[model samples]
Target: MRTNTTPTRKQAPVINFACPSNQSGLTALIARLSAAVAEVEKWAPVEDRLSLEFSKTADKPKVKGGVTKAQQLISDGEPVLDLPATDWFFHTRDAIEEGRAKALAEAAAEDRAAIEQRYVALLADWDAQEAAYNSKKPRGLAHAKRMVSKAHRAWSAAEAAIVDYEPQTLAEAHELLAYAGLDGKRVFFTPGETDLKTIMRNAAAAIALHGLN
Candidate 1:
């Protein structure tokens, strides 16, 4: 006669894993970097257009108006209208244009410089944080919880396979459950084995009964 005996599996040892808590900090840093890059892109187009406009009309005066000798006389309450209409155009055009071009160029240059500086700093901080996050191993209760969740998912999959097998007898079902990683030792059911709505109605009835009591 031949006999078959079930083999006992040895218990596996637990491993300690490390979890980094700076994930949120790293996420914030990445968000900052994205915002900084967006700011640079936003400013680039306006600055470029302004710079190009100034460059194209470099010879032309940019600023249009300033205090003229005639305007000054008018401001001084002199009868300027009595004199030939002041040649306002010839006196101020060149000076105003030149002043405006210079001002536009200077402002664009300053803005571009500031954007570059901020972008570089954000890039550096983001890179450092990302590197730190990558280097650390996941640890602690959070890691344990993740592992437990994974195991639960695996068990659920096993249960699904067992259910699909459609064993006719309780023994056959228990055997399939055992094959699918369940020990077939314990069973748990919600009170009254009812659906959610029924459970809720029962809870309301219990509350009302307690009130009457």
Candidate 2:
């Protein structure tokens, strides 16, 4: 059997190799497509004229000139070359106003702090003065008690003068003592003076008697 061994027709090379020209054509097509997509992306609501100009350049590769053509188109025009004047002016005005407002607020805060500090200092001074006054002043009730005790001692000493002086009533003794100046003024009663309880008892009796007569 004559074997038909035309080496089993090897599958044609899977990859169809492209020529340099084909590769260049593909690169140009890709670049054009990219430009067209970029132009569409640049379309703006505010500047319809600029968008239309970009679109025209993107669609006509001849007008585009090359990959840098889109950038050239944007850089060429009068409106494109000169930045939006109104936007620049508005931003500048806004920056100035913001700075002024911030400065004013800072000044106001400083003024408030100064006022508060002054008031706090005044209060501190007032508190110090009040503390000094309180420390120096004598207590009225304590002073009155001391005076009353001294007078009582004097009265007791005067009473001792009357021997066998168990006066029937404290009131009678108070009357006699008042005449001797022992009821009101301070005096040195003897060292072995009457006890506090006895003095108080006598004083109470004296007040009662004087009230009756």
List TM-score per model, in order.
0.23, 0.17
lDDT of 1: 0.37
lDDT of 2 by residue, 94-115 (tens): 3444544554566766576665
What lDDT does candidate 1 reach at residue 109? 68
Alpha-carbon lDDT, every model: 0.37, 0.36
Q: Residues 176-202, candidate 1, lDDT per residue (tens digit)?
A: 334333233333111221232333443
Cα RMSDs, all models: 26.5, 56.1
- Residue 64 of model 1 has an lDDT of 20
Indicate the TM-score of model 2.
0.17
Model 1: CA > 4 A from native:
1-121, 133-150, 170-213
